[model samples]
Target: MLAKTPFIPDKPILIVCGHFGSGKTCVSVALALALKKSGKNVTLVDLDIVNPYFRAADAAELMKANGINCINPEFANTNVDIPSLGAEIHSVFVNAERDPDSVTILDVGGDSGAAALGRYRQMIERAGYNMLFVASKYRPLTDTASAALENLREIEYYSRLRCTHVVNNSNIGDETTQTYVENALDFGRELSELSGLPEAFTSVVKADFCPALAEKYPDKSFFFIDNTTRKLF
Candidate 1:
């Protein structure tokens, strides 16, 4: 069984944004599962219109199996037709805001996909949602932080909501170890301080050793999920 962490907010609409391959889909799915396990009604919205790979909608079946609601465009026919896609997904933000007990997680596209944020700016601003940007120092040069912040500024200009936190999701595949997790956390803290953003909202780590790891790093708060964990304030 996966250990449940209480770091998730009860009923806020959370927008998870990151560069391509920054683990946005993985983190969004894990967060939905964790929040559901903790008895919150969680819904995941796939706004990744730019990327065809690693889409949150691709995992709709898995999410539905876990009793979580997934909202995305539907493929009704064998030959994909743009006209066949339904419009229900476009209204997610409006619907989510009406239900105070439900938490909606929006997994938006990244980098070039920053334009998608513009399309939903009105809905997001009206809903008063919170945004989180996922960052991985291991995948790119340290300058990735600056680039991500720039992209986020573009997103904020369109989405009308400032990104309030960053999630450091550094990892080295299965080779990830406790030390690697610690170093990532340290890097994230430094980056957060340098950027004048709040301390990295959380550092996501693999789950196999996180409980013990969390105990050891008590000064740094954490939230554990299946195969991954995060520290959030």
Candidate 2:
């Protein structure tokens, strides 16, 4: 096993959003778990009111077992598709903003799903947030840099918030390879140039290959995904 590199959120409110099938929930789940493992007070909020398949609430039980506070929509994990958010989210944000040691991660849904974030624009703007825009080159419509940038714009427009960083989460699930990830490096570089956003990091699922990729590109940061949310499928 490779010695893991920790990914700590600089801002207390860290928002994770991206296009459909970009693995936002997976990244959020992995990140929340990582922060909690590092002894930080972590709260993971499932802000996904769009896609029902890979919701972060799918891992709510796991996160609670790991001592991470979790909040999900009322109809989450059910057959309903309501965009209902509880009043507790406001309290969580208020507390997180005041507590320096606390970190709240929002696993937002895709383009259309980001509309749920618009309601909390004032709260997020007041507390300051670091939004990570995830893009996958392997995904259907977002395979190209131009396509990905367009999707980012839609997400930003819907959320009424801008992305602070870009994360290349390109992978073909368990079939992801070193070569495929290398291709995404080029895609990420182009996307960064186009969007004018600094890269937060790239995510790789295979622990064995992650070390080699990290060594190959010392300038870029890499986070090894532990494949937690895949069980939702």
Candidate-wise lDDT, in order? 0.67, 0.87
Worst 10 residues of 1 by lDDT: 224-233
Clashes of 1: 1
* Every model's TM-score: 0.82, 0.94
Candidate 2, residues 30-50: lDDT per residue as tens digits?
888888878789999999988
| Highest TM-score model number | 2
Clashing pairs in 2: none
What's model 2's overall lDDT? Answer: 0.87
RMSD of 1: 5.0
Candidate 1, which segments miss by more than 4 Å at Cα?
A: 75-86, 141-148, 157-160, 199-205, 225-233
| CA shift of 38, model 1, Å | 2.4
